[model samples]
Target: MTMSQQANDTSRNPGWTSTALSQLSSVVRGASPRPAGDPKYFNGDFIPWLTVAALTNIPESKTIVFETAGKLTEAGAQFSRTLTPGTVIIANSGATLGVAKILGIRCCANDGIAALLDLCSDVDARYIVYQINSQTDRLRTVVATGNGQPNLNTGLIGAIEIDLPCKDEQSAIADALTDADALIDSLEQLLAKKRQIKQGAMQELLTGKRRLPGFDGAWSFEELRNLVQTPVTDGPHTTPVFVDSGVPFLSVNNLVGNRIDLTDLRFITREDDQIFAKKCKPQRGDVLLGKAASVGKVAIVEEDFDFNIWSPIALIRAGSSVVSKFLYYQLQSRSVLTQIAVLTNSSSQGNIGMGDIEKLQITVPCVDEQSAIAQVLSDMDADIAAVDDRLTKARAMKQAMAQVLLTGRVRLV
Candidate 1:
């Protein structure tokens, strides 16, 4: 039998029943007290007031919300309804739509949320949250769309139909998914710690504060133009004609921290590329610095692709004195970034001009020292990237597990 048919058959058995949410719980729509910003309506010693932002602190597998950001006055509590612990809450409006959390403490929520109280004895709160989260896209689609803001009322949320299994089966599925969530959470935390270590390394190594072992040369400060073989230049001032595919045309958005991200790249015809190349054609090993909206973001060209850059990107070809990789890190240093910020703030267009970019000061070491420093930083980057890859795979695995367990395709009980 098909999975759906099997689920239906199980529901027909004595212990299981497929039903709408309204049949299992009483849906209570939340409310906001009058004079929302008034001191009289807030900061009371009574109940905790919950906002949609507070739900974010709750873990994915968790069913309880212990604390919230805001508190309500006694008068405010009279206008709002308080939900007991274990009550399921969903953010029903705004960008946080479909986000679900369970109440661990008694609190009153604003109009942006809906609370499900008095859940049936046979139902598990965590399983219900998982089921609702799995169908988040569908719930968002059902919300009214138009000039008015899309929102969900208690009636609409209560009408959602779910395929129910026996209480034992529900608990088993919830446990499996909860374990998977824990693995993902662990990986995410490790990745965050690795990134923090990388930032600290950059702060020390990029500047001359902490010297690499065996390298003890005094660094030299020079204008960015002096460090490059060619004059500091940018791409075409005017927009070029874009085509389906020919040569990749990059902008400030393509520069992602010391690396070029080809994703979401625009294209230009070969003819247009040839014309734009006259202004600033990026060669392999050249450092690209964003001079526009995202000022001072740097990326080293690792590939020798026949590509051109947009006007907002400044291309720098390191001379014999400095290596491209070393210059890229130097540009990202706090000292250089502070200068860029000052220049950017003084400009009317909120961008650093080519003239200002050429005059920006940077410190550089000997070529051999530069290469050694680059290698050390590069190794740290690889470590962080490895952790990030593992985090991605863990999340993907959890998503696949959810699909099977929530659908009853692979029964655990």
Candidate 2:
């Protein structure tokens, strides 16, 4: 079958919308420079240098400080950085391992960073970086050569054979992909604003500064235990329990940015799901509180899907004293995670016990007010989710286009 057939679209990337895998050029592991704090090493000259940390920062612009992570005193370029504009820098190994970035400015990179350059005219630096992003999973699969620290050497990088296109077509494909990315970025920014707006709304409403319309009520401070049913539960942790197909199971990874991704889900069997249903099973309208590692992500299950949790999650169902939506908004508020982290029994990663959340005191407004506030926040969420859904479809479209165009199985005008 042609590559276009494989990607399921023919007209998207006409000139074989191109992407480069990777090539191991000159790999440098990085040097223990005499510390940035050392006066001898840090002469305080602004020489642009790249590191794995620099690559991790997506929007890093200014060179606040630089001498590069590794020192090459007069060996070849000395303090003079060697990166040219539009070069692809790959983090072969480091704390921020495997991240790739496009350099706007030329700078000397640490030995821990691998530089891929000198591509043919058909390839663009930024385009190559984008392609490598798609190839990172494959790169990771083949990382087996480092002494103890596996790395992407020149050999491994060069062998990453991706389909190619003419230079202009490559640029066009990159531009289109970048357009989708920029839309996603804008949606993300809007999501951030929504969070900030909701935070303000919460403080105002909960503090009685801004009362919702028709809110006539008094609140009695009560134990959280009195307001919520059994608030704790564990997940199915036994190995091989993961069925090839069954019910969607939620672990700590299921929670991201205070939201549960219903897509890309796993399934549990009818029998096992029934067993865990009482303890960790998630019902519609119930909130899932992260109890370990990535703590304080609160998501209310939207539908009745067969889902069980691990020990790191606390399933909370607020009783009549509160609305689940209100409580979920409260948990998702800005300071809630910080507060929860402090209360958790986190030896390595933070973890909040069901008891930790139960004893907490929150100034909850009357039910009607809580419902109104929940509605406002939920509206903002719906707006964001709409944008997210659009972006997801757009990206899927692009993926289909890539498959078809890059394989020369389809043509585009």
Candidate 3:
């Protein structure tokens, strides 16, 4: 027997039944007035409104829908479907088809949304939402397409087959997954708070507005060219021939969160590496600032591995006047970033010339104070990274749990 058949085998899995979703809830498509965005049809204060854009905008870890960018007046509500709190909804059309959430407020939904109303009291709305999410890709295959975007209308949605478990089992499964989601949400919130705290620290410490203890040395401003061992330089002007495996080639995308990320790297030949290294070979203690497309982004080369940068990245080797770690953090400061922004030409993709970057001013402090501030910020980054890793694992665990629980492979009761 197939997994689906095994899942619905009442003899083996007691209290589980094979049934279409329409048996448990009334599936109804939302409505929209003709000429969407007409003054008479939209932009009034009746209730929160839902669009596929808003539905998909919600964080994937959240199941409750409470907020939206647009609202509709009573006149508009007459033309749309106003669903009450606790109703399960799915984006039934366009790219967001099959995305699901439970309404947390009474709101009118536009045509792109489908509401699952009058759910049987024994059915757990959250379990249904989780099930829909697990099967989003499969459901998309049933979408009807013609002149416009693909759509899952009421008839198509009501026909979706789902394996149902007993009410108590359903609630247990939903509660377990919801707890997993809450843990992930808390981790995400903590990460954001840590980042904000680091930003505030940077604003004060890097500018000399708040000096570290035992550091009362006067601060001085110096142009970047004066403190660099080499005239600020970039990689080769032309793209090198890529190879299957050689020196890892880096562009602005590789500069992630002040560190070089080699996960999605391209490659160049060893001969080409020698040529590029002469211009912009990255080594430990050097800082990289994004010069094009993603202006002002900065990352420090903290590893001893071999890598080469493209023209979009400018390399700076700090002279004895400044510590490399201090220079890396200083480049991330608002004062320096603002300077880069002002100098960047945004006509095409934004770019700052090497000469322009070299002319920018940097605030200097005693080496000891520079090291102190950098250490504090670096510690905070480590804390945030730790929490981020936990969040990723939490999300993955939730997905795996849903796969088994919603499929009736594991009984929660």
Model 3 alpha-carbon drift over 4 Å, by segment = 1-14, 33-41, 94-96, 140-148, 346-349
lDDT of 1 by residue, 264-355 (tens): 88999998888888777899999999999888889999877888899989999999998888888888888899999999999999999988
Positional deviation of 56 in candidate 1, in angstroms?
5.0
- Mind sharing the TM-score for model 3? 0.91
Better by TM-score, candidate 3 or 1: 3
Per-residue error for 141 in candidate 1, Å, reads 3.2
What's model 1's overall lDDT? Answer: 0.83
Worst 10 residues of 1 by lDDT: 1-10
**Per-model lDDT:** 0.83, 0.63, 0.86
Q: State candidate 2's TM-score.
A: 0.71
TM-score of each: 0.89, 0.71, 0.91
Q: Give the per-residue lDDT digits (tens) of candidate 3, residues 38-101.
A: 8887888877878888876677879999888888877888888888999999999867789889
* Candidate 2 stretches greater than 4 Å from native: 1-37, 42-45, 59-80, 95-100, 116-127, 130-134, 143-146, 154-165, 214-220, 229-284, 292-295, 304-312, 334-339, 346-354, 411-413
